[model samples]
Target chain A: MLGEVEVEVYAEVKPTESEVKVKRAVLNIIELDELEVIDVNGVKYIHGKARGLSYLSRIRDLIRRERIRDTARDLLNHSVVGDEVVINVNKQAAYVGVLSFAMGEVESPLGPITIRIKSSNPQQLIMWLTSG
Target chain B: MLGEVEVEVYAEVKPTESEVKVKRAVLNIIELDELEVIDVNGVKYIHGKARGLSYLSRIRDLIRRERIRDTARDLLNHSVVGDEVVINVNKQAAYVGVLSFAMGEVESPLGPITIRIKSSNPQQLIMWLTSG
Candidate 1:
């Protein structure tokens, strides 16, 4: 019942098939810690080990406002990498490739993560929401 | 715990200092359809809403195989991009970016998933693991 949430009700629109493929790749290629995505009554979630409002909530807001998903698909299709590139793709999937404003050199992972979720898996989603 | 699963434990050696930044950037930048990451004793995971053990599991195996996190940080640090190039930095971080074996693209909030975790958020991780 994501819709039932009394909050402002912020949710990004669903993504397309191709976009899914690219994101899956990004996670595969990079991300160290794996996050869990659980959906209940339509509300999706990324399980984390930290406290506070989870860092991703901040990222998600930016994604929705900037429409980064669609932009990513465009970059994927055309293969564009620049400081500020405006990707033009069909069907406006809404995405953004943020130029990290942070600093410091990062190393790699101690080992790969055990699990990763990039989209909604029907069975797991059902299990996650219903089990709880 | 994850080690016992046996399957090559393809887990990336684990991420360090700054690379998490760039990879997190990539996630915020262009991916759609949120993924879940569940860590059991330390195996991070990304949960998908699809079937067949989830698509992101494929991505994780890749993350470990390649050292994209180190590369992402270097990119985030020096901001480099090309058809093919080298990402040299302080230490040896493992990461690789596959241009894309398929066409089209994407990852996001169905309605801004109620739960989103980027790193080890702590409590939730405990809840997730203990509950299971």
Candidate 2:
């Protein structure tokens, strides 16, 4: 669990009219990565991550391929919107299966950044992500 | 776990300049509940909950008083933004301690509604919620 941490999340905002329409749906994705995770002692700060247009386009291909299906299925079948799914990446190996739930890399002032996808039907979005 | 379901999440947008500032921060809360969860077999659709302005003010007291500290602590100390925190509520009572993680009641066309709060330091917000 990355307690007191922040990560970018992306989900296709609109659903495709058809299985074929999933591509269009993928275009309407909304990302909310604007909160930072500095020490949680005093002042709480919030800001959006500085990701660019080219990165969004680049990730479209990754989403289209369904690389995150296992992780999506885990989230969809087990949790809801407000629920937290902790992914541990260090040596202790807290959880198994998918070590990386993050989406494609994007450039940021913090250096390269990645995002996790949060959705109502994360599994269904996997279909949309991999569909067309 | 409310799998295959959608729920609204709210969090204060700004931090208070002082301990007194938390009140002002509480006023700048942002909500993103514009999503609907129909069966995930086909045609995905998205829409916002038609909650009214009165309800937002109504919940402000709940946020101010820190009614959700236990739940927020559970989240802040354990999960990250992208992780899903599955909360089970029902006759079975799979998860205990705080049975109601929801903030407060609000009217919606779907009937009365409730929201969960998501933030970088959900625990600290709990402090603000209970502070002054």
DockQ per model, Cα: 0.02, 0.01
| Residue-level error in angstroms, candidate 1, position A68 | 1.7
Which window of ten consecutive residues has the lowest lDDT sum in model 1 chain A?
A4-13
Encode model 2's per-residue lDDT on B1-132: one tens digit a residue.
111323343221111112122222222232343434333343222223333333233233444454665564554445334423222121011111112233222111111122433434444433444344
Question: What tens-digit string does per-residue lDDT give for candidate 1 at A54-107?
Answer: 223443344344555455333333322231111212111112333121111121
Q: After aligning candidate 1 to the native by TM-score, how far in Å is the CA of B99 from where it should be?
A: 30
Instruction: Output DockQ, candidate 2.
Output: 0.01
Best by DockQ: 1
Please tell me the interface RMSD, in Å, for model 1.
15.4
lDDT per residue for candidate 2 within A10-95, as digits (tens), equals: 22211101211222222223234343333234322222343333323334354445465556455444433453322212110101
Per residue, candidate 1 scores C-alpha lDDT tens digits across B1-132 of 221111111111121212233233223322424444546576333332322212224333433345444433333233212211122211111112331111111111111111122222323222222221
Query: What Cα-based lDDT does every candidate model obtain?
Result: 0.26, 0.30
Give the number of the best model, judged by lDDT: 2
- Looking at model 1, residue B61 earns an lDDT score of 41
